[model samples]
Target: MFENLSERLERSFKILKGQGSITELNVAETLKDVRRALLDADVNYNVAKRFTDDVKKKAIGRNVLTAVKPNELMVKIVRDELAELMGGTAAEFKIDGNPAVILMSGLQGSGKTTFSAKLANLLKSKNGKKPMMVACDVYRPAAIEQLKVLANQLGVPVYSEEGSKDPVSIAKHAINEAKNQGCDVVIVDTAGRLAIDEEMMTEIAAIKKAINPTETLFVVDSMTGQDAVNTAKEFNERLDFDGVVLTKLDGDTRGGAALSIRKVVDKPIKFVGTGEKVDALDLFHPDRMADRILGMGDIISLVERAQQQYDEEEAKKLEAKIAKNQFDFNDFLSQIQQVKRMGNLKDLVSMIPGVGKMVKDMDISDDAFKGIEAIIYSMTPEERKHPSLLDGRRRKRLAMGSGTSIQEVNRLITQFDQIRKVMKQLQGGKAAKMAKMASRLRRR
Candidate 1:
């Protein structure tokens, strides 16, 4: 997401490469590069300057232990400074009140509606809360319908009063409806103007007054860069928002918004919209973001994501099947699907330690499994359940049906067989054999 900034920061760190110790001259050289990188990323000029200064001060003040190298210490200092710049710790959403109300405020086209749906889905799936969305964007004719469609897709209830011009009353009624439905959280999606206007401010203020939301989030487009900070300042001046929601982070945004918003508005970023999908919302974590910006992978978050998507019962059953030599195409497909469910393939892979830098220049498409899935889907049920049933004739037919070559089909079968064998060895606690293979690959 912050690919440009990441590359620049990595280059900045290289200024300390082969250096004997962290010195004032070396730190200045590196901070200059760091400042340029942040400015290029669209970070506010003042914020960027302050950030680099802080990083330099921290880097130079380090004790320079004999165990740690200068470049490593500099990287650590910059990572800490970056984390502080982006809100030192993660903030939790307030869902404490009975039928807690969360009011969403943002300019038009700021992804408020989409984020509302994503938040609902996140709460529903992650927090196990019953969330109901209230569509109060009554000005736009299609806004309410859009939110309704998203709510339906998320399988969440929507409370909206069509043709109602009064957003405050609509919000009030929606909250009451949420209470009636026993919803734990009521998210009121208010209307947004093309720009900041008094009328829009007055209406959102009234809605906030009426509903008395536990959390008032100001959603901004991260692609807006410095303009995002200005928008947040205006919104916070009026609504006094509790947190920020940075949207469209999956895009090639320079990452100016996320870095500047917290420093400008003094509000923690509560959530980030990574993609357009309803399940693409991620809780903002400063440490992981710092790691990402430094070109270091976030293994902790990766493990957490895996744990979230890992089904213990399903894993047990799959292990049993593997032990019995019954791991077929169907099982392989299921495993791939589970990994896909965790997150985008590139993102998930980049979370592995050392893999991010190794594959930073490589193109890993989200649909990396498309060909394999197509081949598997072309197989008959019996063939999927029993790979041995796929003889040469069956392989040719499957290849034709899947629009792939026979060689590709055979390659997949061979890889699947090898994977199953390795998994069986692991299950048998053959760590020495696995370590030998890993060592051999590394040597190669």
Candidate 2:
């Protein structure tokens, strides 16, 4: 998401590379470039200046450790500053009260409704909360239906007044319904305007007052850049939102909103919507985000996602197969589906340390495993279990069935063999322990 900024920051750090030590003159040029990089990334002008100034202040006149390179030190300094700028740490959230109320507020098209459901999903599955989504977006046609669709996807109940136009009344009634239904949390999706206006603000304010939510979240579209920051500023002044939710972060190249909104509103970014999937929502961890912004990757988040997808009984069975050299196309297809569920392919790849930049320009699709999956699906059950069963004629038939060339089919088999060999080795060491741990994740 911060692709451009990562590249620019890498260049900025290079300004200090090969230098004898940290000095005023050398640090000046680096901080200047850093400030420029922040500005280019759509960071607020004052925030950019202050960030570099702070980094320069801490950096200048500091003695470089013999073990660390000047450039590496500068990178760490900037990474810390970046994290501090983005709220320093993840914010705390509350879902208290009989049916803990959460009011959703935002400008139109800020993904307020979508994030509402995402938040509910996270609470339901991750936090073990019985969340009921309330469709209070009365101004927008079918907005209630939209929330209902997402709520259904999560298997959560939805509350709405079919003919009522008063959002405040609707929201209040929903909370009462939630209590009656034994729902622990009530998420009220309030109406938003095309732009911030008096009427829109007043309506949400009245709703918030009537409901007296445990938390009020202002969702901002990260793709909007500076506009997102300005909108957040206005909302914070009026609503005093408990936290900010940055949506569309995966699609944004210049993440100005994420970088500036926390500082502008003096509110923590509690969550981030990394993709369109309801499960794409992540608890905003400032340190992990700073790691990403500096091209350091986010191994912690990557591992967490993997842990989420690893199935216990399945893992035990897969481990046994790997040991027996029985890892086949079926297992491979299963693995691919699990990986796909972790999140976007490019976003997942970007989490590997030092790999984000190399793939910055490449188009990494979510369907990266489509061809392999097609080839595997074309194989018969017996053929899939035994690779050697595929003779020259069988391979040709498989290629035709899969709509792939003979060469592609041969390539897949060859790669599969190599992967099978690697899996056998991986089952013998720390990798095996990691797999065991990951598989036992849900139980934890």
Candidate 3:
């Protein structure tokens, strides 16, 4: 997302490389480049200046520990400042009322409607809340249909009057409908104009006043850079939104909006849309994002995503199967499915420490596993269950069926076998450790 900024920041930090201490001269040299990087990333000029000043204040004359290099210390200081610049911590999303109302506000093409559905999905699946989407975009028929389609996919209810032109009325009625339907959260997706105007602002303001939403979020397209921040400021002045939502963060964005919007509008960023998928939504964590921007990766978030797809029973069963040397294509396919549910493949890989830099210039597609998945799907039930039965002739047949080369099929088999062997060895190691611990307990 902030690929260019990250690379520039990395290069800037190299100014302190091989330095014995954090002298003012070197610190200024490094932060000058840092400030340039932020400005190039489309950050607000004042914000960039203040950030570098704060970093300089904390960095200069600080006694560097013998174990920590000057560059590493500078990175730590910069990372902390970046986190503070981006709201310091994850903002709490308010969904406390019996039928909590959340009003979505932004210009057209800000992904407001799509993010409403994504938030509904997140609340329904994660928070155990019944979220009903309210389509208040009376001007756009397609917007209503889009909300309906998204709601249908999430199995959430939607309240919309087809012919009604009154958005405030639709929003108010939707709240009542949500109360009747026992929906705890009502997300009102309001209409947006190509540009902010008196009519659009007045309508949305009236709707907010009528519904009295518990949380009014300003959704902005991060790819728009400073324009997003400016729009956010105008909306915040009018609606006084409770938080911000940055959509299209996975795009080729300079990340100016994410870094500047909070500072300019004085609001916390509650959520970020990482990809187009409904499941690609994430709670905005400033520290984690700062880590990602600095190319340090976000392991905690990565582990949390993995834990979401982890099943205790499934893991035990898989472990038992692997321990028995019976790990098969079916198990492999199931594992792949779980990983797929974790979100974008490239994004997932970027979360691992130090892996982001290596793949920054690479085009790691979401379909990286397509060939293996296809090859496995083409296999018969018997072959999947007992992979050893797949001889050379069977592989050729499977290759033609999957539209993959025979060599591609053979490579998958080889890799699968290697993975199976490694998993078995790891399982054996765990078993040995458990046995030793048991013996120690008995002796005690």
In candidate 2, what are the lDDT values of residues 1-444, reduced to their tens digit? 998888888888888889989999999999889888889889999888888889989998878889999999898888898899998878889887897898999988889899988888889877899999998888787788899899999999999887889988888888889889999999988888888899989998999899899999999888889988898889988999999988988885599888888777889999999898899999999999999999889999999888777678898888888888898888988988999989999999999999998998899998778888889999999998888898899999989998999999999999998998888888879668887667566566
Candidate with more favorable, higher lDDT: 1 or 2: 2
Would you list the C-alpha lDDT of every candidate in the order shown? 0.87, 0.89, 0.93
TM-score of each: 0.94, 0.95, 0.96
Q: Of the candidates numbered 1 and 3, which has the greater TM-score value?
A: 3
Using lDDT as the measure, name the better of candidate 1 and candidate 3: 3
Candidates arranged by TM-score, highest first = 3, 2, 1
- Cand. 2 Cα-lDDT: 0.89
Q: Write the per-residue lDDT of candidate 1 for residues 1-444, one digit (tens) a residue.
A: 898898898898898999988889999998999999999999989999999888876777678888888999988888888899999999977888789898999999999999999999888998899999998998897888999999989899999886778888888888788888999999999899889999999889888888889999999999988999998999999889999999999888999999988898999999998887888888999989999877788987876776676665676687678678888888899888888888777878888767787786788888888889989999999999988888899989989999899999999888988998888777746643544444454344
Q: Pick the candidate with the highest TM-score.
A: 3
lDDT at position 207, candidate 2: 90
The candidate, 2 or 3, that scores higher on TM-score is: 3
What is the Cα-based TM-score of model 2? 0.95
Candidate 1: RMSD over Cα atoms? 4.6
